[model samples]
Target: MDILDWIQNWFKSNCDGDWEHGDGIQITTLDNPGWDVEIDISKTSIASMNLDWILNENSKQDWYGVKIENQKFNAAGDSGKLIFLLGLFKEMIEKIENNTIG
Candidate 1:
C-alpha cells in the first residue's frame, strides 16, 4: 500500500478514544485537552517538497515537521501526546524516505 493507505490503516482500528477519517486522512483527538493528531501520506518523493505543511519553532522538531536523514537533532520537548504522535509519523515518513514503504 501507499503511504496514505498505510496511515489510514494505522488509525482505522487504533486510537485512544474518538477519531475521524475523511478526505483521505486520519485524525485522532487526544483524550486530553488542547491536543490532536492529524496524519496523511503522499505518493511522491519526499524531495518533491509539496507536502504543504510548515514547521515553526514550536513544531520544528515535530515528527512530520523534521526532514528525514537530517543529522542535526534539536531538543524539542518532553514525552506526551504530541511526542507519541510524532513517533508514529516519524516512523512512517522514515519508511517512505528509505524506500521501505510497506
Candidate 2:
C-alpha cells in the first residue's frame, strides 16, 4: 500500500472512538522544505508514548520527530520519512500497551 493509505489504515486499526472522522492525521509543508505530520492519539489506549527520529551520519534526509502532548503527538520529517516514523510509532504504541516502556 502507499504511505498515505498505510497511515490511514494504521490509525484506523490502532486507534479508537471515531478517529477516522476528525483530523486524526494532519500533513503540512514546513518552511525548511520538510513535511510536518500531526497525529492525534488522544483517544487511543496508550499513554505517555513518545517517538523520536535520529539522523544517521550517512543520511540527513531520513529523519523523524515526535512531540508528545496531553492529547496528541506531532511528527515531522523530510520526504520519505513519515512511513518510517509511523512504523516507529506503531512499535511505541505496542510497547506502551504491553507496559514495557518506562
Candidate 3:
C-alpha cells in the first residue's frame, strides 16, 4: 500500500474520539529544506515500544533521522527523504505487529 495510505489507516485506527482531539500526526516542512514528521502514539498499541534514534547522514541532501520520544514518533529528513522517513515508522510498526520486537 502507499505509505500515505498506510499511515492514514494507522492514524484512523488510533482515533478513539478523544485521542484525535489533542494528539495526532503532524507533517511539515523544515527551513533546512526538509520534512518534519511527528505522530502521537500515547494511547496506541505500540505506545510502549522502545526504539532508539536512527539517523543516516549520507550527504547534505540525503539524510534522515527518526525516534520515538515522549509518546510520539518523530522524524526529519532532507527534501528527498520524506518517504524514507515515513518508511522507517512503517517498518517499526510492522516489526512490533509481527512480534519481531518489543
TM-score of 3: 0.90
Clashing pairs in 1: none
lDDT of each: 0.41, 0.67, 0.87
TM-score, per-candidate, Cα-based:
0.30, 0.64, 0.90
Off by over 4 Å in 2: 1-6, 14-17, 47-63
**Winner by TM-score:** 3
Cα lDDT tens digits, model 1, 9-75, are 6556444344334223334443323234444333224433333333433442332333322221111
Clashes found in each candidate (C-alpha, N, C closer than 3 A): 0, 0, 0
Higher-lDDT candidate among 1 and 2? 2
Residues 9-38, candidate 3: write the lDDT tens digits: 998898899989975988999998999999
Check candidate 2 and list the clashing pairs. Answer: none
Candidate 1 error regions (>4 Å):
1-31, 39-79
